[model samples]
Target: MAKILVLYYSSYGHVEQLANAVAEGARAGGASVVDIKRVPETVPEQVAKNAHFKLEQSAPVATVADLEQYHAIVVGTPTRYGRMSSQMAAFLDQTGGLWARGAFNGKVGAAFTSTATQHGGQEQTLFSVIANLLHFGMIIVGLPYSHAGQMSVTEIVGGSPYGASTIAAGDGSRQPTEIDLAGARHQGELVAKTAVRLFG
Candidate 1:
């Protein structure tokens, strides 16, 4: 049974939704196990007391041991100022010990993200996640242009040649479009299949 870790940092729920879609795709492609982990919030003390702000639901904190048990890892994040959120970055930074030990060497890696606007730096966020995988010597996988949604014309709202994505409306209440969901699933399946081929 191959296990894939779906790890992410999401604010306003968009990225979490994308992560779920990615996991669904991985499962559809016959991955035996999928674990979803969320990075913890890190708001300043002054802002923590604000009524408008609330602590994000924290997923299980991933340890170096956790990385060792997985055949592949799929990372997701919301776009933050043309980059991945600092929480996600901090999570990756904690993996320095794993990198030093070559714990992820040759393992499969993939990324996904969501943005508040159509042009809100989804690609940059994906690449930012990919960069950390590279440091760990993990092979990066991405959604191919061959996916059906990629060729469709009905407003491709999410996913890309880089990885999975979603475009939340300005108000942040809009769910991902069906096309976006399909693309995310495709990305998950592709990464799972690649991991199986490479490591199984």
Candidate 2:
């Protein structure tokens, strides 16, 4: 059994759903504990007036200290110019001490994201998150080809070998599809299983 944390920052609720799906997958993967958390929003309320950001998210705001407690971490964020959201970036930026101290060394790490378009920097943003996890000395985990959802062709959705992702419309109208959630769950299972095998 392992403790897995699903942490993310979602602007329009899509990533929130993705986070839940990932957590569910972790639980199903035989983790002893699974927690879902969110990064504090950096955008000023006034600027996000029409952004449709979910105001009632229930996930607790995550802290750098929490990362030290989890056996594996699965993080998600919305795309910001082929990168992770500034909010998530800000939270991760505060972990410099943890990085230097090897606090997350050997822990499993994975990432997922949502974008406005099918090709809207999904892989780039996923890898950007992965780069930071690598610096923390964490072992990277990804949704391997074993998950058949990675090869979806019936619809334009989000899921890659890098991680799980979803296609949100430009107007933030689209939600994650079945395939997207399935992929997210797969990533969670992989991370949780890996964590348990290594740490337990």
Best-fitting candidate, scored by lDDT: 2
lDDT of 1: 0.82
Please provide, for model 2 over 1-200, each residue's C-alpha lDDT reduced to its tens digit, 9 standing for 90 to 100: 68999999988899999999999899888899999999988888877766666767999998888888898989899999999999999999999988888889989999999999988999999999999999888899998888887787877868999999999999988989898999999889888889889987
Off by over 4 Å in 2: none
lDDT of 1 at 176: 84
- Of candidate 2, the 10-residue stretch with the lowest lDDT total is 46-55
> Cα RMSD to native, each candidate?
2.2, 1.0
Q: How many residue pairs clash in all the candidates, one count each? A: 0, 0
**TM accuracy, model 2:** 0.97
Cα deviation of 32 in candidate 1 (Å)?
1.8
**Which one wins on TM-score?**
2
Question: Which residue pairs show backbone clashes in model 1?
Answer: none
